[model samples]
Target: MELPPGWSALLEDYVAHLDAERGLSPHTVRAYRGDLVELARHCGVGPAEVTLPALRSWLSAMTDAGAASSTVQRRVACVRGFFGWARREGLVAEDPAARLTAPRRRRHLPRVPSRADVDLSLASVSARLSEGDNPLVHRDLALVEVLYSSGLRVSEACSLRLRDVDRERRALTVLGKGGKERTVPLGVPALRALDAWLHRRPEVAGPRSPETVFLGARGGAMDPRVARRVVHAATAGAGRGAETGPHGLRHAMATHLIDGGADLRSVQEMLGHSSVATTQIYTHVTSERLRQAFRQAHPRA
Candidate 1:
């Protein structure tokens, strides 16, 4: 759908602001742009002409069309942020989205793999590693170990440069969301796997390859999608059959940390979450798992 010229120009400016001033990721900026475009398409007017009725009608139409509550909530947030920016920037005299409301997005507990499941997955990768000193196998082993051990996001893991690793400290300097950098500890297993892969990195390293810690088969920078596939294949090979991906491994790491008595603030820092509230979900995950265990083990009814 074609956006109003005014909306297009304003959105472009706002996107630039999000990228430069706010340091939002490209993915987030793209989402904001898409949401605003949809809103502008629904309104079919310049930014100055958008009114509360038009905004409400657009949201009503989305609801009528059966958009998910989360989608609606995100669009609402997008509009609120955009219009708030417009008002502050004098692009519009008033913000019509101020009165907009959306359904609360339901938070489902994420399926966190058990420690045994993660162990089985890593063991599957390790067993493959035993066949030969295959560089790709070493890379896969290191990737899963790092993901499960440090709870690094797949993107963060992929973004790792050789300089980001500190062998003596046993840590990785991960650049996370919004370009925030955090140091995450590497477990002994992950460190060993990483060492093995680094030793053989040259075999796959292409001439054009950067100093990226992980590389694709051709030795270019590792793609997050490919990394996700590696994680899935490892888990599926262990009999879990795609039950978890990189993020699931991250969740498992956090849950295990909490279950092992790690503090919430420390876990939040390690996961590079900007808010502690986001990390609190793992506590909920732990509680839910405990309830499940009680239901299975307790005989009293």
Candidate 2:
């Protein structure tokens, strides 16, 4: 859909603001741009020209078109953010989207892999590593171990450098969302696997390669996609049919930690979550487990 000529420039400015001032990732900025562009098309107006009625109608149309609740919520956020920026910049006399409300997002529990499944998967990966001195095998085992141990996001894991690991302390200096830095402790198994990979790292690391801890097949820094593939393959090899990724390992780590009686604040800090509320989701998982156990072991009748 073609937007007014001025709207294009406005969108470019908004995206730049998100990138520069907001420090949003490229992927996130692109999502905001896409959603705002759709709104501009639906309203057939420029940023300043959009009315509250038009904003409401656009949202209604999106919901009526069968958009998921999360999709609608994101779109609403995009509209609100764009107009909020515009209002502050004097592009609009008033924020039309100020009153816009989206459907409350459904809180679906994160899918966590069972401890047995994770154990089996790690056993399978370890068995492969025991077969030979393959550098890639060592790297894969370390990657999965670190992911499960630290609950590092795939991007965070891929972005790690040689200096990020503290060999003596068994800890990692992780840069997480919003460029926040946190130090997370590594388990003994993760430390051992990581040490093994470091020993064999030079065989594949090219002279031109950066000091990235995890290297790609060609010796460059490992891409997040490759890291995800390593996790997926390892999980599948354990005979688990469910789709699992690095983030699933993160979810599993948090749940397992909470189940082991770890405090919410400690888990929140470990996972680098800015808010403790985000870490509270693991309590729900624990509660659900108790519910299942009660149903199976106790019968009032």
Query: Per-residue lDDT of 170-277 in model 1, one digit per residue for the tens?
Result: 999999999898999999999999999999999999789999999999989999999999998887743243248898899889999999999999999999999999
Error of 2 at 279 (Å): 1.9
The clash numbers for all candidates, in the given order, read 0, 0
lDDT of 2 by residue, 44-130 (tens): 877778999998898899889999999998888888989998999998899998998989888767767888888988998999976
- In model 2, residue pairs whose N, Cα or C atoms come closer than 3 Å (at least 3 residues apart or on different chains), thus clashing, are none
| Winner by lDDT | 1
Local distance difference test values of all predictions, in order? 0.90, 0.88
